[model samples]
Target: MSEGTAISDASASRAASSSAPLAERYAEAMIPVFGTPQRVLVRGEGCRVWDDAGRAYLDLLGGIAVNALGHGHPALVDALAKQAPQLAHVSNFFATEPQIELAETLLSLAGAPQGSGVFFANSGTEANEAAFKLARRHGGAERPRILALENSFHGRTMGALALTSKAAYREPFAPLPGGVEFIPSGDTAALEAALAPRDVAAVVAEPIQGEAGVRPLDPAYLRALREATRDTGTLLILDEVQTGIGRTGSWFAHQGVEGVVPDAMTLAKGLGGGFPIGAMIAFGPEVRGLLTAGQHGTTFGGNPLGAAVALAVLGTIREDGLLEHVRTLGESFAARVLALGDPRITEVRGAGLLRGIGLAEPIAPQVAAAALEAGFIVNAPDPSTIRIAPPLVITDQELGSFADALPALLDAAAPAAAGAAAPVDPSAAPAADDKDPS
Candidate 1:
């Protein structure tokens, strides 16, 4: 490299760190794992967040489905405010009411059978990491193989990354703990064939593969997984990191369907309504016993503060009937978007508020960029799919605003040469998955 270029780069970094801008300073201080920040958001309320520049954008992504109650909801704030003043945390040697209560509530909501158990962690990957250990323990030396699905995203930790199918995410950390295999998603035959040997330990899947363009697995396919895994004595682990915690209008997305109960399930993301908390539920005593005492532990997994907040989030969802609202709004949400008759949109995929607006062409990145410019926030999970997971508390009017602006967003994103537009009359309003569970 030239000395002049090196010196120039160093100067630029120094300037950015000094006082250039919040985003520039972020680049100077943080690693480039996420590439760049779309905006330097300072604060948020309800379904909107304000950037450092003071511009407000509708938060359609809802922090990628983590902000279940939107922002600054009194339930969450009060829960933390109250809990922090009380017993905020306790060592694992002892227990707390909030933690125990949260576990019971989650079990009841999940319809977990008698003798089920819950293990808490700080994030989804940690939960999956625990699930991975359980799977290995269940398999022991004889049944060492584990199976995951193609286009699946478990999490980012090494164990979870091993279960994740994307080559890009798993390749860099090559030689990840082995015995993990990927099969065609939604393919019943492949699932059966893979389990024929009865040598696999556990099969992990997401009801809706959120990171993989929000594609939802078929309910029938999930049922097949349950039957096959059960027949082979293999554990069925559902990764509901994105679908659980009422994001899909239910305790878990799988509950919206029927006859697809997993032997174990992973949870996080919206569980604490933006607070860091993750959980793995063992469906019955047998599976729960897989992880005996001292086999695994965490210091702050079920801290009272996070537990209290999660309880409040769950309680508010039930009290406010957000699940039914999400369900009704989700159906209408799809129809309304299609009613526009815009040729660019292919279909709305996913269950409840967890949706992906599939495009006719690979213009999702451009559309996401245009969305931000138009005072809206969405993400392109894939080149052809725009993911929108607005807070469960989001209203029809708020979503209608985005729907009303969708055409302009698409227009600005599409190639200029692709001409001729259709008239769209978006009547503002609200109305209205996958692997069967519960």
Candidate 2:
């Protein structure tokens, strides 16, 4: 039998055994924000996972770039186990040592001084909220307008949502915070014109646009932003929520760029190494003091439990030299992918562990489904963009396995574009294998 036939058979079996019942349970209990749960994953370990049915998968998506150290890393598990037993919950009325230390460590990594401060939150959106508040408060009357890029994604909260450029996402939640303007990313002239009035509070951008299919900004454009913001005293906010913590093979994506020290930056996702935590790092005092004692607070933002987990994650990244690992592994991974010599791939773009494979056709969803059937986990940002943000600690051997499986995945996902028409939607398209994992 053909390989496609094998994949279809496997899909059929999984559907018949447990996938159907689990999907039905999800339909009854969960909101459809993310559609049905693609797989009922039950447990995971170092770049791999097992679904509820005991099938294993190489998790290349890394929990959407949240599992920097990968799932069930000893550091994170031990930290959580130790901290949870000692002190898990504490209100924001008091401060914690771990929080303060984590803040200082993050600042140091960002090339900021000792006096730099951080505001902790539970997720990237909340961290962005803190950064937004500080930016607006510091802008005063000079410029309250924030210039964002089109096709950029910050987060989903009301405040962050306003800065998000996707219409479908923003249309449902109207009346977002005012004074946010959209501009074409990497267009220096357009950015200058948008900020020329000096009425813009800050220019917010993702060093690498994660949600928009791993699009990266031009270095020259970033330098121009630095100069323009300085000329008009506008703040530059880099939302590194998905790009930071070694996912980019660097501490921060803007680190090597000249003359671009952002006033405020938001980080989350991989910061806690799979634990729930977020942070807003403010630099240069322009907007650090904008939030007063009671101006902003989160009840469980920097509690002992989260701080402990964050510290462990950071410590491991440093001690294990994951930055170097990401740099080396990412280069090899990208090179291997490029060598696939597949015509369907339009382009590949990324910094380090976080990358996107742009397909010539709108078959990303299909590609992802096919990959899942092959015991690999990946995500499609849009119909043509396949996002590949694996764990920062992912090994070359694991990536090699994925490299071998990828051609088959792309062929199955976009057979029509490759001269064969698919019989159904890619997401629901039946695979050929009925028993094989890969």
Candidate 3:
């Protein structure tokens, strides 16, 4: 063949090889846990991601609130690159500088007392698992029961799953760790009644119920909970996995509720800025020593790489003043979307960067689909709610673009009639693996 013919043939061969459908490949090689892959994302920068097909999309969900600094941030990348070769993985028996510094940093950020302690884990579920064990130890044998709020989500691990109130998520894993009770969220009376028995080990709550469509616990109710738990001597564990790390315009969501300090708080998601790290921070002397040395542990929980990345994330959030930026931008975004008056929108909820757009009808899935088609990524956490958790580093220009497109997106997703059922989506059913909190 001639040189030109050879070049053309090579190009065609490469194209043919690359043409295999990614979804088909995924189905063949991986379990159908998350249903079909929405899109084969290949690259990301700032607040944008590109699919294997080379389509660019503005990432508004931020990897379900895990991407605090946005994709491929220089600080996180630099920290990880620098630490990886130095001392990436170290056993708990050995101490690493990054781990100690990150722990101290987290405690200071949390305003924990002098006697506070921290336990590192690999994910949000593990963090909650550690906190669960702490509560168990603190409560001792006599106090066996635990109390969690209705419509709350902690994590998906068996121990954390027991604390989660969604029946659908918990029932399948049936006969979970026992002695857990679910009370109506934000009902101080119900909380009081549940703790009145004094048999409760801990009262676990999420300052904002992210999985239940971004419902925030009333500040007053949270304060009441603090008092109730204090009176009953029950540990109060706040699952800040989805709301911590400045996702809610603060170091932690519970801080918004004045005078309410949790006995223990689980941190993850934004921590490590997408590198997968989790921590259980215990405050006050009472609960600090509950988890003894041999009581709990992990292989790669506080590895140097993850610790360095977390330090970089926390440092950037402080130095860059992203917390205030998130506060201002979040309020503006919510107000602008609500002002569109699309009639289809009922309300806007949540604080800081974590937002939920409530629709008049059950059209969130359709709205999310429409948004995706429009080059935006969002989450339909429930049938009636669209969760928007863009990265804290997102610029005003990006927020403005999304705000301008909100009305059109909602219009495209409008329901057929007043009481008509939501359009059925074949893939909406539960997958082999449980769904993660949005």
Encode model 3's per-residue lDDT on 1-438: one tens digit a residue.
Answer: 999999999888767756578866677668786898888888888888878777777889999999999999999999988999899998888999999999999999999999998889999999999988988897778899999988988888899999999888999999899988899988888888898889899999999999999999999999999999999999999999999999989999999878999999999999988998999999977688787778899999989999999999999999999999999999998888888877878988999999999988888887787777677899899999999998899987787777777766766566532344334332321111211112
Q: Order of all candidates by lDDT, from best down to worst?
A: 1, 3, 2
Residues forming the 10-long window of minimal summed lDDT in candidate 3: 429-438
Model 2: how far residue 239 lies from native, Å: 0.1
How accurate locally is residue 250 in candidate 3, as Cα lDDT from 0 to 100?
95
lDDT of 1 by residue, 320-339 (tens): 99999999898889889989
RMSD of each: 6.8, 8.7, 8.2
Highest TM-score against the true fold, candidate: 1
What's the lDDT for all of these models?
0.89, 0.83, 0.87
Give lDDT: candidate 3, residue 112: 98
After superposing candidate 1 on the true structure, give the runs of residues whose Cα lies further than 4 Å from its correct spot.
Answer: 1-19, 416-438
Model 3 regions lying over 4 Å from their true place: 1-19, 415-438
Collision count for each candidate, in order: 1, 15, 0
Which residue pairs collide, candidate 3?
Answer: none
Error (Å) of candidate 2 at residue 414 is: 2.5
What does candidate 2's lDDT look like per residue over 1-438, in tens digits? 999999999877666765456767677657788877888887887888878777777888998999989989999999999988888987887777887788878888888854568889999999988888887887777777888899989889999999999999999889899889899998888988887776888888998998898988888988888889888988888999998888888888887577778878899999988888999988865467678888898987888898999889889999999999998888888888889888887777988888898888898888887778777888999889889899988888887777766777776766745667544323322222223242
